[model samples]
Target: MGNSNDLRSKSLWMDIEVAPDARPLEGDQACDVIIAGSGIAGISTGYELALKGLAVMIVDRGRIAGGITARTTAHLAPLCDDLTSEMIKLRGEEISRAFYESQAAAVDRIEAVQKREAIDCDFRRLDGYLFQALNTDSKIIDDELDAVRKVGAPVHRLVGVPLAHCGNQHALRYPRQATFHPLKYLKGLAEIIEAKGGVFYSETIVREIEERKDGSVAAKTDSGVITAKAAVVATNSPIVDTLALHTKMAPYRTYAMAFAIKRGAIPDALYWDTLDPYHYVRLQPGEGAADTLIVGGADHKSGEADDADLRFEALEAWARNLIPAAKNVTHRWSGQVLDTIDYAGFIGRNPGSQNIYVHTGDSGQGMTHGVAGSLINSALILGDTAKWQEVYEPTRKTPSGIGNFVRENLTAVKNFAEYLAPGELKSLDDLKPGQGAVVRQGLSKIAAYRGKDGALHARSAACTHIGCHLHWNSFETCWDCPCHGSQFAVDGTALNAPAVSALADVKTGD
Candidate 1:
C-alpha cells in the first residue's frame, strides 16, 4: 500500500486513451447561448440545443471536454445514491418516485445518446449495486428499495458471494445501468454539436455574465464578449455568483485508485458500500495485466485536511480485505464535487438571476445528476415542461436545504483560519527540494516556492477568485484551496478552470 503506484496521481481513464480532436477556445465567439464548461453537462446540453436550431457556443478555459469528464469513474447508473430515500422522507412518495424516475431517465439518456450517435465508447448495460456495510443504516436502503420498486427502476435484493461478509444486507440492484468512457462519449457529441451549428471556443475564459437593460445577457471573456439571450454557468460549480452558488454547494474530495488485479478477482457488477464514508468498486477492460479495479469514494471536506494520502491508505486496506491477492496498483487520483444539503442537485436558473441558469451540487453521483441538470436547464431555458423542474429547482427550499446551506457556510470559518494559521516553515529559504511554502508577509500570506530551478519566488497567496488563502500541495506542486476548488500552479499561474484570472504578482529574492 505504501508503494507509489497504489497511491497514483493522474487520471487512469485519461492516461489510457487519447481524444486527438480536443482543442482550446481560440478567439471571440457569438451565439444564441454560451456554454461555460466542457464537462458532460455542458457538452450534451450544447449539443441538444444545437440540434434544436439554436446557434450555440461552447467554451472552456483549457482543452474541450477535459475537466471532470476526463477523470470520472463513469458509473452510469440511475440509482440516486443519496437522495432517493431522502426525498421520500423530506417531500413525499410522489417526489420520491420522481427522483428515482429521474435517475432511470439518466441511464436511458446515456443509452439513447450512444444509440442515436452510434458512439463506440464501450457503453455497456450492466447491473449496478448499492450494498449495505456493517456501519451503515439498513433503514435507508430498505426505504430506497421500496421507492425503486414503485418507480419500476431495475433495483432490488441480490446476494453477492464475494461481499457476503461485510454486513451484506439486501442490495438494491438497478438493471440496465451503464458504464462508459466519459471523454470518448463527450468528444463524440462535441462533433455533433459543431455539425448542428454550435460554435466552440477553447482558451476563452468567461469573466462575468450579467443581464442588460434591453434584456440580453453579456458574457465577457478575455478577447471579446458574447452577448446571448440566455447564459448557462456549467463551469462545474458555477464560477460566477460566488456568494450565492458557492455557499449552497460544499466541496467534497473523493479518491479513486485503479489497480490491476489477477483475473476473475473482482465481480463484474459495479458495487458500492453503504458505510458512513462509503466506497464504490467496479471493473474495466484492460490488457497485459490483471483486470482494472476502480475503487472510489473516501469523502472529505476539500482542502481542509490536506491528508489525501491517508484516505488513499484507507482505500488500499479496504481493497486488500476484499481481495488480498490484488496488486500492481497503477493509478491514483481524486476529484471534488459540490454536495447539496438536500442530498440532491441544484439545476435551473440561479435563483435570483433572470435567464441565467446553473447546475451543480451533484454530490458523488455527478454523472446521473449532471445529465439531470442538463435536461433541467434545457427545459427551463426552452420553457419545456417536465416533472423534474420543481424538485431540482434552484429556488426551492426544504429543511435539509437550510441545514446544508448552513453546513456549507462553515467553510468561511476555515477560510478565516487560513488567514491566521501559522507557517509550516520559518522562511522561503527553508523550503526543501520538491517542496512549497506559505509564509506571512505584512499580514498577507504569500505562496512562496523553491522551483525546480532551485530559485525562490513568492506571490500573493490570496485566491484570485474569492480571496481565500492558498496552501502548498507537495504532491501536485500546486496551490490548492479548501474553499471553492480553484487550483493554481506553484508560480501562481492558473492550471485548472473556474478561476480564469491569474494571481496578482511575484516577488523573488534568493
Candidate 2:
C-alpha cells in the first residue's frame, strides 16, 4: 500500500486516528465471516455480524477507515441522492418504495447504534432542503415531491432556504435527514467491534477470494489464507468479480470542499439544489469561533477528466455565491462513487458463488448504502431473507436501465480506443518533478511519475483488472482505470479495487 507521501491531498477527517495500532494479518486465521474492506460498509457489516456472536475479521489494504469513507462529506440522507423521481422511473414504484424504506431504516439503525454504543460522533437528525437552482424549472421540485410521497417519505413543499438571494425559490423540505462525522462514527464502531472480538487487519491486501468445494470461502493474501463459512467483498469496487458487477456500474469522481464560517451564519441543515450534477451543502459544528461548511458537487466520470483544481475553484465560487459569509477554504478533497445503472447498489451474494457476497455500487449515497447494505447482507448470511433483497440483488437485471447501461458501458469502449492513440508525453524526460504522465515507449505505454525528490517510477499503463488504458489523475496523484474504477499509486501499488495487484513494472529499455 502507498504511504502518506504518495497521497497528494487529505480529507478533513484525516486529522483523527481510526485504528492507529492496527497491524496487518501475520498468519493464517479462520473466522465465521471475513470482510475484504474496512470502510464504513465493511466495518458496519462486521459490527452487525459480531453482534450476532460470529467471529469476524475485517481487512484493508490501507489504514482502517482511511479509504473513501474518510473522504465522504457524510450526508446520511435516506432519500435518493440522484433524485427519487429518476429512480422510480427506472426501478418502478414497488422496488423504489422498498428502497426508500430500507434506506430510512439504515439511518434509524445508525441513530440507534450511536445512542446504544454511546459513540459521541456528532450524529444529528436535521431537516434537508431540495431547492430549485437558478434558471431551472420548478417542475423538478414538484416531480420530486410527488415521487417522495409515492415512496412513503415525509416531505413538505417549501419556497426558499436560508441562503443568499432567491427568497422565493421553489423547494421541498425533507424532515429527519442526517449528517455526521464519518471517521469518528467509524472509529467508535471499530472500538466496539474490537471489544466484541472482531479482528481488524490494516495494510493487508487480499489478493484473491475463492469458494471451496465444501461450501467455505478462502481469502488468500500474501501472508496467509483465511478460511470462512462466508465472505463479503465490500471493497468500493468488488475485487472478486471482473465482469458481472463491473458492467452494471460506472465510476464517478466527486469533489468536496470545506470552508470556515461564523456560527449561526447558516442554519445547520442539509441543502441541495436541483441540478444535473447537484451541489450539496451542510455544516460541521466547531468548538471555536467558526464552524466548517462543507459543499460538494462537480462530478465527472473517473479517469476521464484531470481538472480538479478548476473543479475546486468552481466549488468555492458556488459556495461563496450562496453564502457570502463563507470564509477561507479549510479543506478540499475528492472521492470516487460507483454509480450503478439503476441508481441503487448491488448488495447480495455474488452472482456465481454460494457463500461469497459483495456490497458495492454506492451511487453517491454511500453513507446510507454502507449501513443499509450491511443490514441486508448480514441478514442473508444468517439464513434470514432480507426484506429488500430483490431491490439490490447483485444478479438482478434492470431492463428499465438498458439505455443507461449502454451509455455507461460506452466509457470502456472509448477508453480501450485510447490504447491505439499516442501517449500524453512522447518520452519520460518530458515529466517533471512532482508530475506524472503516460509516455509512449515504442509500442507500449508507460505510466511515469517523478517524485518531488526527482525519483522516476514507471509501470505499465494497462489496468491489472481488465487491461483497460489508464488515465493520470492530477488531483489524487494516481492512475485511474476508466473501465472498472481501479486506482494505482505513483509507485503502481493498487490503491483501490477491483485491481488488487500493482501495475506491472515496465521492463527495462522497453
Candidate 3:
C-alpha cells in the first residue's frame, strides 16, 4: 500500500485529454444569463437555455472539466449515495419518487445529448446492484428493496450476481443505469452550445455576484463585469450567499482509483455495498488500450484529517478482495463532495435574492444532480413550471436531517476552539521542506509552509470563510478549513469556494 502510485494526485479521466483554451473575459459583457461555473451543471444549463434562444455566457476559474467534474467516477445511476430508505424517511414517498424519477430523467437527458450531438463518449446502458457487504446485515438490503417498491422504481432482487466477489449475497438490481466518458460528453456539449451561439470563458474568476437596480444581476470578474437578466452560481458550492448554504451543507473528501483489467474481466454494471462508507465499482471498455476497473469509497470529513495514503491503501485492499483480476493501480484521485444536511440537492433561487440562482449540495451524486440542476434551474429562469422544482427547492428545510445538522454544526463549533489550542508545531525549526504547520506567535496563529526551494511562506491561520483555523493537508499540500472545507494553496491563495478571497499573507523570517 505504501508503494501506491503518486499519480493519485490527478484523476484517471484526465487520460482522455482535451485542449480548449477560450479567452478570458476582457471587458464588460451582458447576456440573458451569467453562469459562474464550467462543469456539467453550468454547461448543461447553458446548453438548455441556448436552445431556447437565450444569450448565455459561462465563466470558469480554470479549464473546462478541470475541477470536481473530472474527478467523478462518471456513474449515471438513479440510485443516490443516500439510501432510498433514508430518502423515504426524510422526504416522504412522493418527493422521494420524484427524486428517483428526476435522476432517471437526467440519465435520459445525457443519452439524448449523445444522440443529438453524435457524441462517441463510450456511452452504455447497464444494470446497477446494491448488495450487502460482508459485515452488513441482510435485513438492510431487504428494507431498501421494499422502499424501492414503495417508491415505484423498477428494481429486482438478484440471488446470483456475475461477480465472483459477492458469491451468494442477494443484491437489489436497477436496470437501465449508465456510464460514460464525462469529459468527452462535455466536449460534445460544449461544441453544440457554441454552435448555438453560447459563449464560454475559461480561466476567468468571478469575484462577486450581486443584484442591480431594474431587476438584473452582475457577476464581477477580474477583467470586467457580466450583467445579465439572471445569474447561476453553479460552482460546486455557491461563492455568493456564503453563510446560508455553507451552514446547511458540509464538505466530504472521497478517494477513488482506476486499475487496469482485461476487457470483459468484469460485468459492465454498477456495484455498491451497504457499509457505512461503502465502496462503489464500475467497469469501462479499454481491453487492448488498457481498460479500467474504477472503485471509490473511504469518505471522511474534509480538512478534518490528512489520511489520503491510508484511505488509498484501504481502497486498494478492498479492490483486491472483490476484483481478483485487478492489476497495478493506474490512476488514483480524491474528489470533494458537499453533503447536504438533507438527502436531496438544492437547485433553485438563492434565498433572499430575486435574480440569483444556485445549484449545489450534490450529496455525492454530482452527475445526476448536475443535470437535474440544469432541468430545474433553467425552467425557473425561463419562467416555465418544472415538475420536481419543490423537491429540490433551495429554501426547503429537512426536519429529519436536523439531528445530523446539529451534530455536524457542533463539530464546526468545536473547530473554532482551535484558536486556543496549542499550535501543531512548537516552532518553525521542526518544519521540513515542502511541509506546513500551524505555529503560535505571541497570541496569534500562523500557517507556515516551507517550499521545496527552502523558502518559508506564511499566512494567517484563520480561514477567511468563518475564521476557523486552517489545518495542513500533506496529501493535497493545502491549508484546509475543518469548518466548511475552504482550501488554500501553500502561498495562501484560495483554491476552492465558499471562500473567494485568499488568506492574508504573513511575513516569515528565516
Candidate 4:
C-alpha cells in the first residue's frame, strides 16, 4: 500500500536469494495461531510459536520479508530515533528504560537463535552511535546522554572520532547494537519453523479476518481459509482491520541510496544525522554487483514530499562532503516507517477486539521492535502477561505523550487536508512544468504526468508486481509502490526490480 508508480522502477535492499512465490492456501487449515505478513516480525513470531509446539500458519501478501524489512536501511539501535530523553519524557522513565532493554534483549535473542540454529545472516554486534555533528554545542547531546544513562546502558563519549573540518565532535556510543541481512535472518528462521512443522505461505494474501462467537478467528485467503484461535497482524503496517492502530501510528516515508565503496568506508559502526530529515549511513560488505555505502533517511510522511531526486541529490552531496570518493549510486530506494504517537510501540489486542492483535509503530527501530513485537505478540496470545506488555499496550495512552500527540497529529491533519483541496490537476493545458495527477479512466486507474517541458503523459497506476495502489512520489518525480521495492520514472517506464513490466499508453487530453 505505497506509491507504486515510481516504486516499480528501482531494485532495492541488499538483494539475496530468498525465494517467495504466490501460493494458494489449500484446504481448511486449523492452527492455534495465524500470523499475517511474513517479514521479520511475522516470521519471528511464527518461529516462536512453532518452537512452543503450537500449530502455526505464517502468510504474506508478497514474498517473505519483502515489505518494509527489505526496504529498511537495517539499523538496529536502542537510541529510539528521537532522543531517548524525549522518550523518557513522552513515556515514563520506567517505560522508556523497558523500551531500551527490550531492544537490547531482542538483539540478544536474535544472536542466541542464530547461534543455536547456525543461521549465517551476517549478524554482527557493533556499537550503535547517537553522534552530534550538526548541532554539536546543542543540549540534545546532554539530554540524550542523560536518557542513555537513565536507561541503564553505559554509553561512552567518543572523544576521538577523527573528522576533517566536519564537526561531529561529540557522540554517545552504546555497545552491542547490531546489523544484519534482514531477509537472510527471516528466511533462515522460516526454514527452521517449517522443519519444526510450521507452515509458511508466500504470496498468500489474507484479504479478510473474521472473529467468530468463540473468539476463534478465520483468516480468509484467496485459495482457502485458515481457522486459528488467535491471529497476529504483523504485516509491516498491519493489513488486518485494527481499531485506532492506523491513527496511533503515522507512516513516515524515508529514502536510501547505495553508492559503490571500499570495504573500510566507515568501519562497521553505524551513523545517523541528528537533523530534521536525518540521514543514516552504513556499509554493505558484499551486497550488490559491487560493494556500496548505504545512506538512508530524508523522512517525510507517506504522501508528503513533492520531489525525491532532490533528496537523492542531497544525500549524494552529503556523502561527497563526508566521504569525497562516494559515487556510483547503484541502488536508490525508499521505505515507509510506522511511527507511534508515543515513543514505544503498540503490541497488544486491537482496543476492543479480543482475538485480534497488532505489532506496529516502531518509528525507525523496526528491526529490534519487530523482533520484540514477535516475542510480545506470542506472550500476549498465550495469555502470558509479561511486564513488557504493560509498556507496549496497543490501547494504552501516554499521559506524558499528550504534547507529542498534539504536535504530530496536528501535522497529520494538515497534510491529510491537501487531498481534499481543489485538484492540483488543472486539466492537460494547465498542468505544471513537471508534476503528476491520479485520473480515473472508466474502470481503469491512470497516473497522468507533465514532463519538464510541460508535455502530457499517462500510464497505469497499478504496480505491475502486485496490485497495491501507487502514490505520486513528488520527491522522486516517480511512482512508488508502498507494498514492495518498485519505482517508475515520470514517463511510466519501469526503473525498479520485481516488476519488469512497463506502463500502458497514456490517455492524453483527459
Model 2 TM-score is 0.98
Top lDDT: which candidate number? Answer: 2
lDDT of 1 at 411: 84
Give each model a TM-score. Answer: 0.90, 0.98, 0.96, 0.84
lDDT of 2 by residue, 1-510 (tens): 456324757888988888677899999999999999998899999999999999999999998998888889999899888899999999889999999998999999999999999998899999999999988899999999999999999999988889988588999999999989988999999998899888899989999999999999999999999999999999999988889999999999999999999999988999999887999999999887789999999999999899999999988988999999999988989999999999899999999999999999999999999999999999999998787999899999999899999999999999888889998988787789989899888888898888888889899999999999999998898999999899999888999999999999886452
With candidate 4 superimposed using the best TM-score fit, by how many Å does residue 213's alpha carbon deviate from the native?
A: 0.9
Q: Candidate 1 residues 130-176, lDDT tens each?
A: 77765556776787777667655666676543653654565667677
The clash number for model 1 is 8
lDDT of each: 0.73, 0.91, 0.85, 0.71
Q: What does candidate 4's lDDT look like per residue over 250-286, in tens digits?
A: 6677888888876665567787656776778776667
Query: Candidate 1: worst 10 consecutive residues by lDDT?
Result: 1-10
Candidate 3, position 253, lDDT: 89
Candidate 2: the clashing residue pairs are: none
The CA lDDT at 72 in model 3 is 91
Cα RMSD of all models vs. native, in order, equals 3.8, 1.2, 3.0, 5.6
lDDT of 3 by residue, 1-510 (tens): 111122126887775533375678899999999999888899889989998999999998767666788889989988657899988888789898888889999999999989878998889999999988875678988999999998788899977566665878778999899999898888888887888878889767798999988899999987999999999999898888757888888888898999988877778899998898889999877757568899999999888888889999999999898888899898878888989886788899999889899999998999999998899999999999987998888888888989878877886888878889998899987889988899987788999988777878889999887788888888777787877777787777776777777789876666
Where model 3 places Cα greater than 4 Å from the true spot, the runs are 1-8, 15-19, 287-289
* Candidate 1 segments whose C-alpha is farther than 4 A from its true place: 1-8, 15-27, 134-152, 158-161, 164-170, 288-290, 495-498
